[model samples]
Target chain A: MENLKKELKEKIIEALNLEDLTPEDIKDDELLFGEGLELDSIDALELIIILDKDYGIKLDDPKKGKKIFESIETMANYINENRSK
Target chain B: MKSEITHYCQIKNGKVIFDENLLYEDKEVDFQKFIKNAYQFFELDYRKFYKMDPLCKLAVMNSSVLIANLTEKLDPKTALLLTNKSACVDIDLKHQKSITEGFARPADFVYTLPNISLGEISIKNKLRSENSFFIFETFNPEFLITYTQQLIQTKKANAVLAGWVEIAENDYNALLFLVEKKKGIALKKENLLNLI
Candidate 1:
């Protein structure tokens, strides 16, 4: 679970080109949207791809991502519970 | 107050890809060959444009190169006002094809928005100021001047790049001018349109 969260943090930083951030700077419980990271709808789409490709978790509707990707904590937990591959 | 043409470049087709040495006179020239020559000089680094709708590609390519050259070191509060026609018409066609083909690419859909070109230019130039794009059947020099002046006078921008950029399947034209307010050169209304 720890390793998956770390990887997820790295992927988020890379896909979004958050140039000033490092993996360690992303707190596990920090909100992934709005005030914490300020990620918007488009970034949500990238996160959806990351979930599908990295964990084999296919989210058919983008809206479903709000709960799964609420934070690094939630993402790690959801992946641990439902990742297919 | 008026601004002088301190720096200028005009590229057409592909030959003058990114040449900063292009100079235009009041006389009309073979715009097509000029564009072709401009293309030959610069190879597009962005592959996404190749896959974009053709009209979208033309608009993106033209604006991208100019913005790339003009803002190598961006001036603060620079405004942009551009005009075009049949914006992303080709993209609409491709979008329809995607629906028929059973899968639509998200990236293609993103470019289909006409305003995306303005965003792309702003991103590339690091310009954060008054910006607008218009779709018109033909060029209107008066509108371009008025809108650009408003941006400057309202403090929304310090300088403006204004022009008409039109592209169809086989036809394209770009007439651009960099405008700003400064001392020494008094900009007269009568000669404004003829400057570019």
Candidate 2:
């Protein structure tokens, strides 16, 4: 779980082009939207693609991304259980 | 209705020249490096700019300089009109290659359309007016003049940001103008062509 959380943080930074951020900068429970990361709708779509391409976890409905991508901890937990690749 | 060119900017030959003055000139011949240097030279903080494709990046960089000197608040009704010869064909080919290789990047995929630059500009400047992108065989000042005049005369927009932005194979050119109802050179096709 610790390794997955770290990996998820790195991937999120790379996927979103957060050049100024590092894995340590993202708190495991930090909000990914609004005040925390301030990710917008387009970033949400890109996160969906990341889930599909990197983990082979295809999310059919984009609305589900809000819950799944709430934070680094949530994403790491979901991917650990669901990642096919 | 009357309109004039308030400010303008051009990016060509690895330089960002604003209002007839050189703002940035990169020693590196690399296109990406030059863009990064220009962005840094201006001290711009818009993080989303790093994610945009080259074409959109050029548009955003050019427009940022064009509007830098304006003291007045940017009217939300300001319209943006841009023309390009290639119309994002460079990025289109790259996206196609990605698909053919069985991995499509979402970042490149989102910029396949030419008009996406206008959206980027609007989002950065907080302009909420109508915007359009036109593809042309070559730069046509007449089309820009006529369309911009119509927009202003019909009260559809209080001002218009119109010009040509083309980026292909490490070469790029952007000649943009801010036209508003102000006292300056009368908005004419000849004036627009001369500025370019």
Candidate 3:
């Protein structure tokens, strides 16, 4: 799970082109949207692409994304449980 | 009161010059690297810059500095009047391919239109005034001056950032100048032409 969280942070940074940020800069529990990373709607779509392409997790319901993408920890845990790849 | 070009910056041949003074240059002249170098040189805080496509990056690369140098505290309604030859064709090609292959990337799709470059400028400057982008076979200084004069005269804009940004075939030429009611270089066609 520790390794998975670190990988998630790197993937998020790469997928969103958060050029100035590194995995060390992002805390596992820090918010990914609104106040923390301040990611917007377009970034959300890019995150969706990351989930599909990397984790093989198809987010059919957009509403579920609100909870699943809350933080790096949540994303890593979700991938642990559901990722096909 | 008449429109005057206060501050101007040019990006061409891998060199960035403001008011005839060299500010930055890249011998490689790669579009991505040039923009990245400019952003780093300016020490920009805008994170949205990373998401923008090359056209918007080109627009912002010139604008970030000029807008920061505006010290007079002009109206928030500063307008943008821009002319471009390529008109986002660079991103449009990639977006079209993305659509054909599978899904259209939202970020790329959003920048397929040239005017979005104006949006990037607006976001950086917090401008609420009118903005326009025109496509021409060449840089149309005449059209830019005419419209800028009209906008300022009609109260549509307090000031205008008028310039040309042409990006095609991996080459780019951009010039942006802030125009106010008075001072600095006279906003004349010949003056604008001479600067180019």
Docking class of 3: medium
Per-residue lDDT of candidate 2, residues A16-83 (tens digit) = 77876889999999999899988888788778877888899999876778889899888988899999
Which digits, one per residue and each the tens of the lDDT, describe model 1 over residues B1-196?
6553333333344333333464322222454334334333455554233334444444555665655576445565877777877776656776678668754545457768666766766665577777788988766766876787677777788777766666665555555566766442233445444433
TM-score of predicted chain B versus true chain B for each candidate: 0.71, 0.95, 0.94
Model 2 residue A78 lDDT score: 87
Q: What is candidate 3's lDDT per residue for B4-120, written digit by digit as tens?
A: 998898988888888888988778667877788778888888888998888898898888777666677757878888898889988899889978977677778888899999988
In order, the Cα lDDT scores of the candidates are 0.64, 0.87, 0.86
**What order do you get sorting by lDDT, best first?**
2, 3, 1
Q: Arrange candidates by DockQ, highest first: which order? A: 3, 2, 1
- TM-scores of the models, in the order given: 0.56, 0.87, 0.93
Q: Is the docking of candidate 1 incorrect, acceptable, medium or high quality?
A: incorrect
Quality of candidate 2's docking, in CAPRI categories? acceptable
Error of 3 at B122 (Å): 1.3
Of 2 and 3, which scores higher on lDDT?
2
* Chain A TM-score, structure 2: 0.93
Per-chain TM-score of chain A in candidate 3 equals: 0.96
lDDT of 1 by residue, A8-49 (tens): 899888665554579998999999898887776756777777
For every prediction, compared with the true complex, DockQ reads 0.04, 0.45, 0.63
